[model samples]
Target: MITSPIWLPATLFAGAVQAWRTALQKRVSQNLSVNAAGLVRYLYGLPFAFLMLGLYQWAFAPSAFPALGRLFPLFCAAGGLAQIIATNLLLMAFNHRNFVVGTAYSKTEAVQGAILSFLLLGETLSALSWVGILCGVAGVMILSTGGKRMEPADFVRALGKPSALCGIASGLFFALTAIGIRRATQEVATPDHIRAALIVLCCTITMQTVMQGVWLFWREREQVSRIFLTWRSSGQVGFLASLGSACWFTGFATAPVALVRIVGQVEVIFTLAFSHFYLREKMRGSEVSGLLLIAMGVILALAGTMR
Candidate 1:
């Protein structure tokens, strides 16, 4: 798009889109309840998903339902379910803590996803990768700790049941999304990796957006009006999300699954940075350490990928 450098334009747009999108979501979160806002977020995304699917069909010949096979759908389904559930859990976390803290806790996904993949899919990690995983896990733990709770046991129990479990589970689901997307792209994009990745992602995430929308409508029929009223804020949350997702899919298509995911892990840094400067959330001293460890872990994980 630019004479200067193709990658620079794309990279800058990608980062700006991601950061602005997060900032918008944070802004919307201010007015709407987190649960309701998450719902608003989901519902607004359906049109984009469908639009992407349509464009894919128009640009490239439509293949089978998924350019990938049946397994693609299954993996997508599982990933979708995980995404929705984890999202709700994340919203709940936001209600209890600031978005940055909730997000720091959410970084546990890097560790959980790695562990899950190792166990479920036989994905192996090297020493460096293990270190990355530990850093991410340690950061998450530090964020979740009850620093000043009078009844630490009760506090621990509360976190264990919802906060911690939800955060970790969300990470596992996010990992599954990454792995599943890669697998789908591999299957569908046998010859043309980009098309395969894009089409499968469009189909799978479209279905996810639809299912989430349906569930939200069914549950919140009364609030649907107010939610629709808030559609004005959908520009960034919905469109930007779609655009950023497309970039993410394209990035994954171009690189190794592990490497791409490593770069994507930069979302944590982006989220933390954005949360502080844009949202006025202050980072705790411990949080700074936690983020450092997570960043270290991501580096180690990237090293493992190179091997």
Candidate 2:
């Protein structure tokens, strides 16, 4: 099998881009629930994803969506649904923890995605890359636990905390989503695979946006005003978030989904750096060390992937 060299770089760049956007989303979450924030970002992104899909279809192939059986759409939809849950959880995570830690929670996707793809989808990595994956996991562990393990009591306590639960749930949701998307896309034995995949992603996101708006309207009617007000205040952040999602989805499509997920672990470092430098937050020594570990892990993982 031929591997694309550019896929690694694309995945890395996507991680950086997504981290920047996640930071923006965290800022927006200061005034919104995870689902409410999802509504904002997806609504912001809906038109753009559609427009991009249309342009891709028009400029290249009008007959892109073809012969996808029922299962393909289901898997694709599952992927989108996973993202919806993940994004909402992410918002909650931001509320529960610092941006860096919340982001570290999401970086757990690397290990989870790898295992899921291997077991559920029969996809495996090279032995070298497996070592890289281990490094990536160790880095994430450092970021999340800071070389310390929670007491079992503390672990149980975190379960009662909505924010912590949300963040961990969101990371798990996204990891499951990545695995599903990989399965669906891999089965694209038809023409215009990328285009069809793009279409599926767009439609799923649109549905997720609508569903979120409805749910938030019913359950958090009082916060609707705040949601809109927050949107106005952080609308640009939403836009940046959409762009980041676009980059991430594109990167996922560009490479083996597992590889993309692994490289995406680098987001923790990027998010912490962004918070320290841009938000003017002081970085703890632990934070700096965590960043170094994550960076080194990613480099090793990428190196193992070299042909």
Candidate 3:
């Protein structure tokens, strides 16, 4: 088992940044196509990612750059592609129904990630951790369903809907993206987790930018110009995206992906805070219940990590 103190704080920071970054992305999406909005994070974040890699290497890495194994590029490519697809699917899902449902469905990434990490990377979570993940999933579902008490049949029927299917598929691909990043980090020659993460981040963002750039150029050339025209908002999205990604990559490098993901579910709480405070929304009874469950889940997951 990998034990590192850094992953906890890294994950917390990532979750907070991700909540804001997502909010920003939503605003930017109103002006651009799903693909174009998705590209904003990578294309604008590319420079920041490079800057992070350069600064970290100059300050902390060995005089020579660390060597990446053959699998590194392959893994980065796979991970980038999965993230791209997952993001676009998620954006599509947002348009189909209430934002609550889409957000709740996509939160399935925590549980799916744990399962995938176990199957693909041979990582295992304790029974308590499994329960915690389930609790988190339940909380997310409840929050998304507007905290309504649902009959078993109602729940089953809801899952069969296209919005749920899209959300679930997005979750699956996101799980794959996390696994790919963790595997790629393992292939780095350096033992410094931060450096390894930065290296992976730099490469992955570059590839994503290129892949998405080509698609946008070919299919939506006009949108490309519009994207730059709204650079003020898109630039903020890119900066936050890179910062959030750096934190996420560091968490992946330092601990099991499942554990990192479980801890990262705190993003929901962050979202709740934003909704209540920033949006001047009153907290509902159900929102409070969902919050408590998510908190309990995070606590239990942390406890399991000690075993």
Best by TM-score: 3
Q: Tell me which residue pairs clash in candidate 1.
A: 109-171, 132-297
Cα lDDT of all candidates, in order?
0.60, 0.67, 0.87
Tens digits of per-residue lDDT, candidate 1, 1-307, equal 0112222233334555777787788787676655566665556765776677677666666655434576867766665666667777766665554444454457666565566556665666677767766665665556555233224354345555555555655666666776666556556635544456456656666677677667656876665566667677865598787777666656544543344444455555677788788889978876677667767766776566567
Superposed model 3: Cα runs more than 4 Å off: 60-62, 97-103
Winning candidate number (lDDT):
3
Question: CA RMSD for every model?
Answer: 5.8, 4.0, 1.7
Candidate 2 residue lDDT tens string, 1-307: 1144555665667678777666677688777766676677777667767777777777767764555556776777788778777876776676665444555556667777777767886766777777776677656756676645545456446555666567667778988887766566555655444565566657666766777778888888776777667656466655565555555655555465667776777777788878878889887766667677767766776666664
Better of 1 and 3 by TM-score: 3
**TM-score of candidate 1 versus the correct structure, residues matched by position:** 0.73
User: What is the TM-score ranking, best to worst?
Assistant: 3, 2, 1
Worst 10 residues of 2 by lDDT: 1-10
Error of 1 at 233 (Å): 1.7
Indicate whether candidate 2 or candidate 3 has the larger TM-score.
Answer: 3
Model 1 lDDT at residue 34? 50
Model 2, position 130: C-alpha lDDT score: 71
